[model samples]
Target: MLDLHRLRLLRELSHRGTLAAVAEALSYSPSAISQQLAQLEHETGVPLLEKAGRRVRLTEQAEILVRHTETVLGQLERAEADLAASLREVTGLLRVAAFQTAALTLVPNAVTALARSHPGLRLRIRQIDPEQAIPTLTARDYDVVLGEEYPGQPQPRVPGVSLHRLGRDPLRLAVPDSFDAADLADLASAPWAMEPSGTSPRRWAQTVCRTAGFEPDIRFESTDMVFHASLVATGHAASLLPDLVWAATPIPGRLLTLPGSPARTLFMAVREGAHDHPAITAFHTALRTSLTTLKTTLPLPTTEADPAS
Candidate 1:
């Protein structure tokens, strides 16, 4: 019989992409990880990893095992859930993965609300990018993931994972506090701090700039929304920001709607088979309610209002 624990570690190495990262995340020493993986390969009687220039790469056999490991881990999670359900109590750790902005401004309030309602539940939150969050959630590292999808961009589809739309955050053009640009076209020559390429927000910002008849001169690149706002405030660079970033503290800038008034939809994702798990269901409810309340409190730009008006 294959050892499920070792299989899980192997699966995590594949998802996390580094032995050091896996060790740090799982709280194991790097040498310990190496020993366990070496033992796993010895027991299976196949070479699972190959040394690249600096990092170890998984062999084809290891990739195959990783795929099956996902199934095995998922089944194990389901079995545990079933046992917990049989006991008729929701008492287990719920791990959540979320991006920076949502983690900073939204999730804390939601967690507080959840704790008030369900005192028995234990929660663990991790700050992770949306791109990584989906895959990790599918691998069962996270019970639920808070993810975002920008307007006109294709949302990533993770097989066997289910998504629930929580709320929409309007995207706006953020300019320097004293600068006056009649429209997006007028700011074509302005320096921009954009989300890194391959992210949904970055793609949307580029498309919006193109549609307005100019390509942006992107001077800085980062996925951190707080840093993006700070650049705009300090006159270093302008950017596109969502309403959620302004929820707890207002960014000192002129917020204007894009030509189409685009909005990014935030959602909660879970493994399709584990949707009925009590902890997942409860947290989802709390998140939705918190977002609903936030919509009323956050400062959102009026689509029809002109910045000059």
Candidate 2:
């Protein structure tokens, strides 16, 4: 029988795209990863990798094995979940990755609730860039991921992960104290601060601007919305920010509800079969409770005059 552990290594290589990355994710050395893949090749009696100048690519045979490995891992997750659910308490470590805003607003409350509700369960979290978060979750580096999707751009479906929409956070135009705009187009020539180029938020902001009939003079680029808020607060630039920014820390600035006033969909993703794990379930319950609290407590704008009022 093939080694299930080695099969996982092969699958991880596919997901992570390099031996060093797989080793870092699983806490092994690159040499060890190479040796294990070599052993797998010996067992199967077929070459499973082709060296491509400092990196390795999986062979067709290795890809086939990874497909089977995915099935096996998923089944194991279901089995583990079934066994865990038969017990009286949920107990395990859950690693989570999230971007800045959710980490600020939702994670703290969820962590507190989980501590009170499931004393035996533990959580480890990391702040990850939006581009890398879900991909890392797919490689089994995280048990769950906090993610957001802007309206009109559905994330492409990733295999073997289950996603649940948490709630929607409204997006609004943030301007320096002196800036004024009756409509999005009025600020066409204004300086803008946005997430770095190639990110979903940057692309979305660009689209929002282009639709308004001019390209923004992008004055600053950063992934941190807090920084975006600061730039707006100080009159350095304008930006499109989400409600979660203020949900974390209230800052003095003008927030305007744009035309259509799109809202971003917040969601969580876990491995497909692993979604039934009791610890994950408990965490999800806590997060939903936090969302409810935000609904009642977060100061969502009622109308254009409300922020001024």
Candidate 3:
């Protein structure tokens, strides 16, 4: 039988990407973490990790073990939750991982609401990209992960994970305040500050520009919407920013909807069987309520005006 404690350490190491980081996160000395992993490997009778320069990489056998360990850990967590439910209390630590914009705009409100409603529930949050968030959630490091998918660029299917749509956010084109470009075609020659390659927004923006008969000249790349908006404000670069990003920071320039005004779907991912846990259920409910309220409070760019409205 694999030691649950050691398995947890292994999951932490994988999520954090280094022994030192895992140690710091779990409040253990690096040497102690190493010793524990070594003991775990000895008990399993297989090489779990191999050093590559200053960092260590998990072996194929270790990867397989980690996958199974996640299932076992999830089951154990569910069992504990069942016992707690029998006691009629909502209690447990719920760790969440979310992308930047959601982390900045949505999570704070959701967390606050959850805290007010369920004082016994503990919540921890980390900001990371969706691509990294899903894998970490599947590894048992996070109980819930917030994710987004741009229209026409759906999220990749990951087995054993379930998605719950929390809300939808519109994506708009931001341009310099002084410039009055009528359409995407007119802005074809303009420089763009886009998300990094392979991200959904970047790909969607590129497609929109390409459909307009010109390739966008990408001048800056970042996942941060605040940074993107700042670039647009300074006339450094125009961009496609989601409404959530604008909610977090004041836009300094004019915002325009693209020809079709695309939107992205925001969702939560939880391990399939772990959804019924009271803490997880409470957190999900809080998130949905927060997003619904945010839609009304945040300013969304109006539909294309007829030059007079």
Candidate 4:
């Protein structure tokens, strides 16, 4: 019989791209992984890997095995979900990843709600960029990931991942107190703080600026939106920030709604077959309830005459 464990290692290698990476992630030695793959080759009676420079690439046969492995893994998840549902209590560790804004604003409240409601369930969370988090999620590092989608820049679909929308948070232009900006066009030449290039936020910010007929002068680049806010607050740079940034702290400066009053969509992503898992379902409910509280407390603009109002 083919070894399911060895097949899983092959699937891991395919996703992680290197023996060293797969080893580090799964807490196994590279040589041990290689030995297992060798055994897998012996069982299959077909070569499943090839050398490509210093690295290795999967063979055509390996790719075929990986497709089947994906289906098998997904079925295993469904089995696990069924077992969990048959239990009396929702109890287990749920690892989660979230970006800074959601980490700062929504997650804590959700955690509190979960603690109160599901006392037996435990959670481990890490602040991660959605770009990095989603891949690790597919690699089985996280049970759920809280991610955001900027308007018009939908995240690409991954075969085994499922996305569930949580809510929308408004995006607005933030200007230094000394700057008088009516719209994005007014700040075309201004120094700006933005997420680094190639990130979803950076791409969306650039598109928003280009649509307004100019490219932004991104003077400061960081994944930290809090830092971006500080720069805008102290008259150093302008930025496009989301509503979640000011959920706790007061707004630092004048806020202008972006064109069309665009808002980023927040969602939770899980592996496809595990969507009905009891723990995941409970956490999703807590998150949505927390968002309800946020909606009640969020600051609303006072007047149409001033964007900052």
- Angstrom error at residue 194, model 4: 0.9
Off by over 4 Å in 3: 1-77, 302-309
Ranking by TM-score: 4, 2, 3, 1
Cα lDDT for residue 122, candidate 2: 90
Decoy 2 TM-score against native: 0.89
Give every collision pair in model 3.
none
Each candidate's lDDT (Cα)?
Answer: 0.82, 0.85, 0.82, 0.88
lDDT order of candidates, best first? 4, 2, 3, 1
lDDT of 2: 0.85
- Expressed as tens digits, the lDDT of each residue in 40-149 for candidate 3 is 99999999999989999988888888788778877876787687677666887889999999999899998899878888888889998878779656556787889998
Number of clashes in model 3? 0
**Quality of model 3 by C-alpha lDDT:** 0.82
lDDT of 3 at 24: 73
Q: How well does candidate 4 match the true structure in TM-score terms?
A: 0.91
RMSD of 3: 5.5
TM-score of each: 0.75, 0.89, 0.75, 0.91
Residue 147 alpha-carbon offset, candidate 4, angstroms? 1.2
Q: Which candidate is the best by lDDT?
A: 4
lDDT (10s digit) by residue, model 1, range 41-145 = 999999998998778999999999999987876786687767767766677899989988889878998889978888888999999987877876755588888
User: Measured by TM-score, how close is model 3 to the native structure?
Assistant: 0.75
